[model samples]
Target: MALTSVAVVLPGRPTLFELGVVHEVFGIDRTDDGVPLIDFRLCAERPGVPVEISHGITVTPPYGLDAARGADLVVAPAYEYSDTPSEAVLEVFRQAHADGAWLLSVCSGAFALGEAGLLDGRCSTTHWRHSDELKRRFPRTRVDPGVLFVEDDRILTSAGTAAGIDACLHHVRCELGAAIATRIARRMVVPPQRDGGQRQFIDMPVPEIAGETLQPVLEWMREHLVEEQPVRVLASRAAMSERTFARRFAAETGTTPAKWLLAQRIHHARTLLEGTDLPVETVADRAGFGSAALLRHHFGARVGVAPGEYRRTFRSNERRAG
Candidate 1:
């Protein structure tokens, strides 16, 4: 269904960062780019009353829980985990899901959905720090702490702060089109999609980049994505030993050479699917997957959809616009 309206349910002591992320994705108007305007509403349990936020500031939502009754998408931003959400808020979630509206939660917001029983028997996730508690409290919900986000049965849950951006963009890409999603990402100055997962943040150390050491090599890699990039070849290009190059690459990119290359190939394949009518085999060959079967395998794993299905969804949107 097209996303025409969005309602954000703000619980007490809402985390400012997560609330900002939701507003940035849905509240901003970009009609000049042919993007559809979403009627975004921020609703609270008590309208016209100021609620304290995490950063010592207060916000007064203009609408109440009743405003979220029939929104196409309902968002729950992160709130204080110790506080129990009111039945009114939980009822909105239950009703939204029953009405077939897309439900999204960021960080501790997943707990509200869990309390409402909306996440029962569905795959979901939350911030890694609270994953165990969520699993213990809602045993019926499959909580994956490693992924940045998970979309199962129209319910979306994101792991932590920035991961919320990834989940929101993924929803836009699926519901609107990749072109519209990409335009939003450009305006926000963030990547359309992020690679790897929340696992990168579990215990990783800060990377140290001294100077313009890896810029040229990274640029070269992007230009030659379709070619074989063995560790030795890349090492030679960077004027370093294979072992040092591999170590430094992981330090800088937060992923191994093979994994990063595969992600880039998949991203290129998605662009081809959205913008061109190229055959799957041809797209696979051009994106360095070498064959249609290999492309479908990786594309399905990363995108949660087959290449042809993705093409049909985005190309149909293109036709409608034209």
Candidate 2:
């Protein structure tokens, strides 16, 4: 049996919430439900040295850099805005990478990982507020300010505070299975997963309350995706010209209305695929795709797998024939 161990490194002025996230996911006993349990430890470069946390709590780690180097996974939790980690922390992270351990950073901890040169030429994300600074500081790292988390092979970086939870849950789902990850999410009273990327968090201009905007029409479009209509019809419903509506819709939703509608149609098609025994052609028609070929093309492009394959792969365990 393979033993999974995760070492969470603590630097000065650590964000306690991020540390607690690591403990919640890895440090606790989770074997009651037959889920894989991890050997998780809190480590620091200078072992046994008292450290002050964000919420007036002080902590001391029994393990040091040696523990970090030996763990299967290394996690760096959040750091303060003004903090720059010591060379000791950076060197330990580099050595951990050299030893082939998976590296994860939550929120501002990506700064430390970047300093260690792991994120060079790699796509990464941080709290949206620091994306500019992270780009300026690490010119080699491609900073994506909009994603909740990015999984680039062995290195994963998450955005903002609560996004750490999403990234950790994603790891659980990837390493274990959706069933185990869903169980863990239920225990934590959080959603099992979120569809789409982090485009929802990207800043957008809110519609004026007194002015006519796309809000009502957008909700109506969502309700009537099965009614095949052209962009002109949608524009008419929103009381704007076709070109104006298209631009405004993109501004409001961070994507074009046509693309958004296609995404919603694909989402509905996936639900039908997972929940029903309907034929692919019928599912396509119901999702307003008009043909299975179109559905297959878009579905495969978006999901990286064909529809029938996805059905067989992700079919609910209870629904499977024994």
Candidate 3:
């Protein structure tokens, strides 16, 4: 659907960062760069009343909930997690969804959608810190904590803070086309699309391992990414039996040897695609993917874009920066 209007709902004590993300993507006028102008409205429970935001700041929204009645997109930014949104606010989300408008929630905003019953039986996500609570409160919603955003049907939910930018840009790309999305991202000085998911940002504390372990083997694997690394060969290098090596590798990395190897290879290919002007086949060979087709298969599955498309987007960003 063509996006012409966006309505952002402000609850009590809203987070300014996620609210800024919505404004940055939709509220900005970039018509000179070929982006369509969107009618952006910031609405609250009461019109012309000051609503308290984070850090002792207050914003007076000019429009009331009626502004969101038929907007093309309805957004709820992060708010206090413990506070229950008013029923009037929840009904706005429900009515907007029923009216076929795209529904989006950033960070703790998912709770409002959940209360509105829009997230029931839908795959949704929120900030990792609140993911467990979201799941506990709404048993029907499938909360994926690993992804930057989850788009199930027309309902979209995003993780914390910067991930809100990723989700908003994705919506812009889907509705307004990649060129417009790229322009907006360039204006914001952020990537049009980021690689990996929330899992990459989550802090994983290292478990203390007493003696000599797979650290050396992992280092060797990184150094020789282009070389074939079968489990048998890797086990021999670690001076352990295949069974022991496999167990130890999984324990240390939280993934099997083959899966870990594939991840490393894909990461290496991403680096080459971003930093170098190599042919796809050459990148495949350097990253141990064997062939261009194989690289495309693995890279698309992991990165959500083909190798050539990734290169073009990366190069476009670099040129914009230059």
Candidate 4:
């Protein structure tokens, strides 16, 4: 479905960063770059009323929950975890869900969705601190605190803070295509997609420069995806034993060498498919999958579509959406 309209519910205490992420992705005017204009609405339970967001900052939304009707997407950003939206506010979500609009929650905003019974019988998550509470409050919902976000049945729930960006870009990629999502992510100065499975917290979140142990090795791995990178070779290059390298790699990148290489190869294949006319065999060679058959196996498993089908759909979507 084409997403032409978006509505964000302005809770009593919406965090600025979470609110800003939504506005950045959907509310901005990027028509010069060929992004379709969306009818973005900031709807409040009480229209034209002042609500202090954080640090005494206040905003007055011009529209009421009624204005959210018929929106293609409805968002509930971070609010106090303990706070519950009024029945009137939740009805807006219920109506949107019944209408098949995509619903998303950021951080404690999952509480609002949970209160609305939207998270029930679906896998969802919130911030780690509030995750137990979320599952406790909504038992039927499977809460995975490890991931950055969860999307099921048109509802997306993201972890705290910047994970909202990941979830939003994911939806953008899903509804539009990788091209549009990458465009927006570039404009925002962030990665186009971070796998939802990545751990929310990592010990070494940002790798050090000056050719540190794993950072330089990881850069080389991406540049050389067409080549084999066994753990022993990687450890030898990093001047560590395989056992030490394995531990540090997990701590630093949150995944093993083999798994990370596979992910990189898959993404590189996606980029090639989206931007080039390379044959499947050639693309697979460049992406380190060895052959078309192997590429099809992994790509279809991860992306839920064959390479040709993905390319066709993405190309068509870029043209139609642009």
Model 2, position 225: C-alpha lDDT score:
75
Candidate 3 residues 260-279, lDDT tens each? Answer: 78877876786687678889
In candidate 4, what are the lDDT values of residues 128-158, reduced to their tens digit? 8888888889998999988889898999999
Query: Between the candidate structures 1 and 2, which one is better when assessed by TM-score?
Result: 1
- Candidate 2 lDDT, tens digit per residue, 1-322? 0237888887556788887887787787877865677788888878898788856687788898778877878998887857778889888888888888888899999999988888998999998888999999999999899877886758889988878888887676545546666677888887555433544355666544345667798778768877876889998887777888776776666567777788778767766776689999999999888899999999998767888986766574323311
RMSD of each: 2.5, 5.7, 7.4, 2.7
lDDT (C-alpha, whole model) for all candidates: 0.85, 0.77, 0.83, 0.86
- The total number of steric clashes, by the backbone 3 Å criterion, in model 1 comes to 0
Sorted by lDDT, highest first, which candidate order results?
A: 4, 1, 3, 2
Candidate 1, 108-216: lDDT as tens digits: 9999899999899999999888999999999999999887788888899998898899889888877777778889999999877666352436655644545456758
Off by over 4 Å in 3: 195-200, 205-322
TM-scores of all predicted structures: 0.89, 0.69, 0.67, 0.89
What's the residue-level lDDT of 278 in candidate 3? Answer: 89
Q: How far is candidate 2 from the true structure (C-alpha RMSD, Å)?
A: 5.7
Clashing pairs in 4: none
Look at candidate 2 and give me any clashing residue pairs: none
Which of the predicted structures, 2 or 4, would earn the higher TM-score when compared with the native? 4
Better of 1 and 3 by TM-score: 1
Of 2 and 3, the candidate ranking higher by lDDT: 3
Instruction: Kindly report which residue stretches of model 1 are placed more than 4 angstroms away from their true locations once superposed.
Output: 196-198, 207-219, 235-254, 318-322
